[model samples]
Target chain A: MHLLAAELNPLGHVMDRNIIGGPDALLMGDPHGTPIVTMHMLTLLLATGLLLWIMNLAAKAITTGPSSEGNDRYLTRGRMAQLIEVITLYLRDTVVKPVLGEKTNKYLPYLLTLFFFVLMNNLLGLVPLLDLQHIVGAFLGDSHFAVIGGTATGNLAVTGGLALIAFLVIQVHGLRELGLAGWAHHLLGGAPWYLAPIMVPVELLGMFIKPAALAIRLFANMMAGHTLMATLALFGLMALSGMESWIAGLGISVIAGAFAVAITFLELFVAFLQAFIFMFLTAVFIGQLSPHDHEHEHAAETAHA
Target chain B: MHILAAEGNPVAVQLLPLVTTVVVFGIAFFILSKNVWPRITKGLDDRDNKIRDEIKAAEESREQARAAQAEYESSLKEARQEAAEMISKAKNDAKAAADDLRQRNEQELADLKQRAQRDIQTAKQQAVTELHSEATALAASIAGKILQREISVQDQQRLVEESLRELQPLK
Candidate 1:
């Protein structure tokens, strides 16, 4: 059982492993000797850079300057650029705009960056780059070496950091929209002043919990999907170690490989799903504090009618 | 299963990655906000406005075309009405002129017939007078022959009167 545990340890694949020099390298270590230039960090940086390049291309394809002629100028150029434009418009017009209203434009960039960045990292994680690196490192007599490739969003620290930013943006927006007194009044949740004692603390705790939930939800989902993939892959090796039968091993490998393939496709869907959820929830939180003009207009129209 | 038995913290939140994410995200956000979003929003807006303007222009031109067609139809109707009026007026004038010409021709024929009748009456009167004179002269010659002497003026007059009475019945 212990042997199986060690052989099938899925965390080894999902966990952040060091790349380049060890902790002894310059600017590489904290006081506790945790390597700063770890696999997840590298992935995060790579995803960010990728996002920048993609968005720049999308921007160029989407925009037609003044003095442009013909109806074709309105069309988004290239399939990839069109796809990006569609997604951006969907999120802006459907997801965020209805909630944020006039403030949708103000918050769109941050929301878009969050969604694409997380999605990129999630997609990159699904690639077999980490496994390839491991195989290459084994040949070089360095089994633990990794240059890149891991789920950055799968990391608790990374998701927590994202949640932290979302929390800050939501709170800052709330403060700006409501001011100090109105913000406090919101904590009361439209209840009487006498209930402030119970409501204020609950509301305050709710604020922290909202972002915390966001972090855990994203991190657990990404980590579990990756761990499942690793586990299925290791099943074949485990079968070989046990029975020493070539047919048994091959059969288990084939079955496990098929399951792994299905999981990969599922993971692809989850990557986009998770990104959308994160952005949508963040927008919801922002909308909670800043009640938009559309809602008031609706109420006014209803009253008139 | 190994997750339960794994050594150290399985879900540890490291300081480095957390900090790196915030810093990196902030940089990305700053760059994209400055460069990308505005242009895309503007492009969408421009397309929408252009479509609206085109639809409005098309509608206006359609209205103008409808108005022009209506005006043309009205003028065509008026022209037809004017032509009908002119034909009716011409018909009336032609009829009136024909009636006047017929009346003038009848009046001229009557005047020519009356003049011929008057001329015939005068010719008859002149012929009667000549006959009477001839008869009287013949009677006077006969009387002179019987007596074998010249006749007087009174005797001649008496004989002419007697001859006129005798000739009256035969005239």
Candidate 2:
């Protein structure tokens, strides 16, 4: 039981790398000793860098190319550009616009950035960069190269930061669309004035709860997938280290590898799905604050156009 | 190997990543909204309008062409109708002219026959008178030879009148 708990919980490895200022207690002889910059942070930078490069390419293609149909225009220039367009257009026309109604165009930039950022971060997490880095490090005497792999989205700080921005956007949009008085009054549901006290406090808590949910949902999903993968992998390692029978180890590894493969595919799907869910929720919340009349007029205009 | 490296708390809200994420997101939002979306939207809008207008114009021209074809067909039918009318009118006029010419030709032939008959009758009377005079003169001369005498002008005239009465049956 002790051995199983140690292997499954794996708290020791966590403690060793969790150090802020001290040298890495295990494995790596990184000249910096302590990793001031953690693995998750590097992965976050990688996702951001990729987003910037891809978006910049898409932006340039849009601005310079002549306006025409086919693969020449800004959105249609390349397969990747077209893919970006498909996602953005689907979210805007199908998901975002119909909800936000009048202020859709105003809030579009923030929404697109959120969707792509989250999606990129999620996708980056799916790559076995960390596993590969670890394997290579094991071969190369646990060098600094192994530090390159981590699921940035799996980290709480990263998701929390994303949720904070989403929360701000939702609140700011409400305030901007409806003035201070209107915004304050929104918390007091449509009940009688006497109910304002209870409803306001409840609604305020609801507001904070929404973003927190977003953060936890993303963090938990990523963490769960990573944990499951690690646990299954640990079984194969245990069979090799604990058992004298090499054949048992080989059989265990084969089973573990197959299950891991299946989970990896599931994780990939979750990455895309979660990003979409986060963006979708944000858009829906923003839509709730606006007036119905504006929505009706916007729908009419859209229908006519 | 640890799947996740715990850093001073893997779950802690680190300042470095949070700030970096925020800044990166901010820059992305600004560039995309300002630089990318506007141009793409404009191109899409312009292309949509242009295609629609061109389609409308093409449809209008096609309708006009159809109208022109109908008009030409109608005019062609009218011209054929007029030509048929003209050809029939000319045929009627030609038939009427042929009838008139036949009538005039018949009248001229009848007048020529009448003039020739009058000339024959005059020639016949003059010849008959000449023959009668000659005969009477010859008879008078013979008689004169036998009787040794010539016939007088009153007697010749009487003979000519007698010969004209005899030729009336033949006329």
Candidate 3:
């Protein structure tokens, strides 16, 4: 079974050196050194930019007025109203308040933007015209390469960059809340001076652990979903290659297509959920540094104790 | 010669994944601190203000509703009390008026009865006086006829005895 698996699929090693190869765009001398402007990055950016433009237009159309039906501006159109209501409620209940608490009000706007931007980018990765490809003259067409870019967050470089930003924000807020002396004291687990040697390294490690985990979580979810779909697609291609029975090939192809579609829907939900989770976790981490968070620190204290 | 130099070589050389990680994380940190974080925070403040305003407005509306309800109840209670007072006042006025009428009528009836009784008593005395005067005049005329002139004491005594016998028969 292992030999058959290897023979049936040559690209079994999913995490290849392709990641370290910088982006193909850079390789082709596109001169756009935007860190990871690879195929996935390009598609992700385009999708996100397009989604943002659409959201902007929707936002502009929202004027304060009474409609012909005597309904308020917020309820003027069913679809637009429904979309706005869902986003607003999700941000307020799920993202902002849970992390920021009463001061959630203070951070709501930033978190909402973060949620939308990440969500839009993740969702765009799941699109089709955004991703179909063709072959041309002994080589896969350049257009095909352009279309084949998959999930953005699936790339370690991208998710790591985002996590790094969150890390900076958490530290900045922590220092701001504690000032220099208090911030130093907090690092020592808010413990006695004698325990400083042990707690300092632990706190330093704790700092990196949070952001590292964030990067991994986002990267893993996006990468795993895309890889599963691609593998299923390869199964159908393999059947076609091995057999003269067109019916069997067609049946495998249909099954592969169905699997891709089901996975795409799941990926879409994960895209939104992960973005929300990242933003929410960022808020929660920052909120820990707030003046009112002594109780949470107390738990950390007991653990250290 | 320069084209030949570029020939037979891959166009792109790959950077180490570690180097890529550093470069990406560095750029993201710079951009976030300088541009993204500020814009996001501004948007956040706006959203915060909006939520707070909504919450405050809701609380104020709820308080106003409570106050209005209290006022309405008080006014309703006052109106009911006023109605009860008015009814009681109406009853009292009616009773007072009835008592005044009854007392006036009773006083008038008593005065009328006294006047009527006095008139009846005076009328009876006047009738008795008139009967007495008439009877006296008749008796005097009869006595003058019975007693003829130029008679002595014996004749007067005989006449008095005759008068007595006639009076007895009449009684």
Candidate 4:
């Protein structure tokens, strides 16, 4: 009876498709624990591969020739290579280098990976890959491989996993850059020693808060956008087909359609923006972990005195 | 449709997904950091450094060119000043030479004029003395011719007076 009802009510079907499935939809059934493959894992793996392939290609294309050769404004050969070079250089020079001044080089690779991975996942979400999977499954007699769709970053676990990684890198840097005594001083928040108890927890909480912001911010942005898009499309679909006459439905659907298009465009912008924010914020956090500048501390001391 | 769709450990993270994600991302990061990143960023850095070196070299060359131009301009100015000095000295020397030549020519011309004037004066004096003697002889001869015989002192005086009267017209 439930199955028949599910089939009859298209709205229920769409609502279920759009919002009802929770984290469970993010996973794919892998019965055996041996092969730990799921939809998010598949997308993650794909993103990693795509990044590797493109980066290698870009590496191969960049030139280090003498001045006697061709134009030298940019480093790479092709358009795609130019795009990659610009992104990498902009992020390194403008974003990463400014914040993490001394150790920009040391942690650049991970940062680059993070930015590209998030960006790729976000862009991939924009494509109707899930629809393609369904079409492909309908053509094939089964839908097992339809797992290759949806926002990989929309999964809390995936974003959480990335945050956890960022968490590790930030802490590790704090330890390395600040050292034992300096790190202890860092915990004191530059107040008198009596304030250690109050300040320590805030500093520690700050450590998690930064990465948590990264994870939640990414997950919410991606998921909310997709949800809104689905809801808008549902509106258009309902408007176009649910009224007394086809013309009436069509007239109303146009408004919904326009709104949907606008939001979709907005969603596209947000995808890139959120990914950039995640990267930019990570760099800022890592930069904060460096040892407090002595001159700055001295000036503060003088001012206080 | 999406809600009914269930796979793996539904809603909960299973062992395999976590492991796969870690493994895949790990491998990707490792491969990238080790193999790709070093070469790529090195290429980028190499290109960056190379371009910077080239720019520095260009700036250095520009500086050298500017210095050389300044030196050349200064030398040119010096040469012009030297040429002006030489030309002015030559002009001054030429003017002095011309003035000296003019002064010498004027002195020689004045000396010639004086000598010529003195020669004319002496010639005129000699002519005057000779004329005086010639007149006296002429007067005696005239007296001799007119008296026809020996004459007395009064006749001689009368003849001399007549001769003086005739010479007056000649003077």
Which predicted model would earn the best lDDT?
Answer: 1
TM-score of chain B of each: 0.55, 0.70, 0.54, 0.53
Model 1 misplacement above 4 A: A1-7, A20-34, A65-68, A291-305, B1-10, B90-171
Please write out the lDDT profile of model 2 over residues B140-168, one tens digit for every residue: 67756876555567765666567657756
CAPRI verdict (incorrect, acceptable, medium, high) for model 1? acceptable
Candidate 2 chain A lDDT trough over 10 residues, lowest sum = A10-19
Better of 3 and 4 by lDDT: 4
Top-down lDDT ranking: 1, 2, 4, 3
* lDDT tens digits by residue: candidate 3, A1-305: 44344334422212222221333332444323333434544544565556555554444333333346343433324475347545756677776676567877656555555566567657766664323442331165342233334565666666676777778878988898789887787777666889989989998887888788787888788778766776777778777877799899889988988997898788888998898778777777777677665767557434432
DockQ of 1: 0.43
Q: What residue pairs clash in candidate 1, if any at all?
A: none
Looking at model 4, residue B125 earns an lDDT score of 66
Clashes of 1: 0
lDDT of 4 at A25: 44
Model 3 segments beyond 4 Å from truth?
A1-41, A57-77, A80-84, A133-149, A190-202, A290-305, B1-171
Interface RMSD of each: 2.1, 4.3, 9.8, 4.4
Per-candidate DockQ values are 0.43, 0.32, 0.06, 0.20
Give each model a TM-score: 0.79, 0.78, 0.62, 0.69
